[model samples]
Target: MLLVRPPGVYRAQEDTSLLRQVLRRRGRRGLVEGRSVLDIGSGTGALGIEAFRAGAADLTAIDLSRRSVLTSWLNSRLHGIPATVRRGDLFSPVNPHRFDLVLANPPYVPTADRPPSRHRMARCWDAGPDGRVLLDRICAGAPSALDEDGTLLVVQSGIAGEQATLDRCEEAGLVAETVARARIPFGPVLRARVPELRTRGLLGPDQVEEELVVIEARHG
Candidate 1:
């Protein structure tokens, strides 16, 4: 089921596709019941909204974008759900090791150059020079932020070295596993680093592909 944006939210200005897919796959896995959920980098609060709908209690929606914080609040209000939307950099503002379930859809687009929109580049698309910057942080911090047996669900990219991300998680003592994956046509990462991928022997310069990988892992 798709979530309708709250009143005053600009329709068509939000991206809820990934959120829907995550919920669809994990919802059936029975992960959201009575948990204290944290939606990191929550844009428009879609992930947290679905978590709330799926039966999570005590939700927190966090984003770097001021606009997203406002929209998340609006969305929460629309759904009659109570979620705390806080503005911060990654998990910096949040208390450590305190979430039962943490969901992050961070910027996985590996870019050598940043985009014009600061919010888009920082919050939506740029992922360091190799796109693993934010992903690495999540992997590292997830262990501490998550409660014992807590799960960290992230939507990443194949173009961003999915195994490398898994390795990062494993290094952090989290057991990584792929929950779902889909091809996202002409995603921003594909457009940004075909040559770099080829140069690094990761891909052929002429080869262009679009793939999205979603991983659900638990901290040990």
Candidate 2:
């Protein structure tokens, strides 16, 4: 299998365990077959590329990282599929159009209390220090970008204030559920997350929880 890599200040590990769980639960219910799809923050285009394999005919992938856009284009070439990968801020380059499926995996690291240099995509990773910044934006903007009955899938950390994100989605007119959850070991970024969580009282001063909660949501 060709390795799938997302480029940026920080590249995601070469794994799709969480995404697979999403497919297992919501894939059949979503517009996977012969539908138009948009991937926001489409790092390396994993989810969108899978949508194509599942039968989505049109795909538009957007990411703020230029390296990510280039890598996505390369990955699409390797997959023998045509995808439009653009480098732009969220929804800036996209017109207000409805899509059968809209997917995103935003950076959900809260850094309000932590040092900034620890994260590469400081803007992407720091979501208002509670990690809900980008997630909230996506939830709020997704309904307008989705077609009637369109579904939006997003993955975030349990520590990223997952419940708050669900609530934000609901406020934005979408119903969300915890479709999947996984424990990802502390990576380079974990060093920073540990202290932040400790300060926030989410974890004991000496205890560090090494896991993230992933959720999938659908628009009504």
Candidate 3:
């Protein structure tokens, strides 16, 4: 699982690993076999590569950063799998093209910053105030991007409101729920935002850990 992770590009962390585990589980259940897969905000392209190995018939990955797109392409090549990697905002590059599966590990850190930085590194994790900038967009666009029976597996921090994600998907005509969850120690970003998050009522005083959840949304 060696990958070329250039600086300023996101390095796979606990959330990434959790998403990978879910992908593997779904693959084992034959959910990903011969399906078209889309990996949004594809950072290092790890999830797309996993889908390819799991027998995805077609795989496309999109990212907002050129470095991330290059990294994804390189990693796909390293694994001898062909992936269509493009640089653009989420779902913009592949509009009107529906997929059987969509995977995302988007930026979900609640930041006080009004708008997230355009810097390559900061773009990886700085979602605005409530951390739903991209999450909300994904939920809104997922129904249109997915085939009638398609499924979406997206991971986000519980601090960002897991129920909101499920509600958004449901509103979009998908059945959504938390499929997996983990309690992890706050990362550097969350640790630094403790005071602000507490003041915003998003975090409890003395809370040192955060829960991460993998949301599975399926079109009926």
Candidate 4:
């Protein structure tokens, strides 16, 4: 599918594809067929578009960046998928409404530098020290935003503490497990922060790649 990612909107990366792969698997099993979906951090509306293609009945998307919101909106239209795309942080834009599935490909890159990075697209991947910035928030908020049988799928880097995310999801009243995993060589962002990742012990000194994991959570 063609997605228009303008100057500032985040370009779909491996994490996005990973999340969609897991979702497609579930869809094949009839789990995502005809279900309501909420896509957090919609970026380019990729997940939202795929959700409908996988048989989702309705779609809602949220993003913090205005450029992303517009990009997602346009992409949805271009794909002929009707989606409600809004600009806001995480779940706030869709409060009180619950869905059968919640999808997220949040920023899970750990950074030594404090937040508010001046990089043009840092918002796309710069998570604080341990990389739980958005992961923790999603773990905390997703449960409440899900229907009784709702499922949450989140993709993140292993360095961001996958176990921590699972624990938080359980604490928030969900049963969580790692559904998928893949190793990717460090990208430019990660390569530049090798020293910080080493200092924080997030990776082994010689580790040249990071594992990406997709976590699945459901109401317990």
TM-score of each: 0.83, 0.85, 0.98, 0.97
Error of 3 at 139 (Å): 0.2
> After aligning candidate 2 to the native by TM-score, how far in Å is the CA of 25 from where it should be?
5.0
| lDDT by residue (tens digit), candidate 3, 71-177 | 99999999998889999988889989999999999999988778998874777899999999999999999999999899999999999999999999999899998
lDDT of each: 0.74, 0.72, 0.92, 0.90
Candidates, ranked, TM-score: 3, 4, 2, 1
Task: Specify the highest-lDDT model's number.
Answer: 3
Per-residue lDDT tens digits for candidate 4, residues 1-220, read 7899899888888898998898789889999898999999988999989889999999999998888899999999999988998988889888889999999998888876687473558878888888888899999999889999999999999899989999999999999999999999999999998997898788898999989999999999
lDDT of 1 by residue, 1-220 (tens): 3445444332321134665567656667777778899999887677788888787888898877777778888778888888888998778878764888898887766666543236343346667667787888899888888888788888876777889888999999999988777765564546666677678775655666656777878965
* After superposition, candidate 4 runs with Cα above 4 Å error: none
Error of 4 at 194 (Å): 0.4
- Candidate 3: which stretches are off by over 4 Å? none
What lDDT does candidate 4 reach at residue 139? Answer: 97
* Candidates ranked by lDDT: 3, 4, 1, 2
RMSD of each: 3.7, 3.0, 0.9, 1.2
**Deviation from native of the Cα of residue 164 in model 3, angstroms:** 0.4
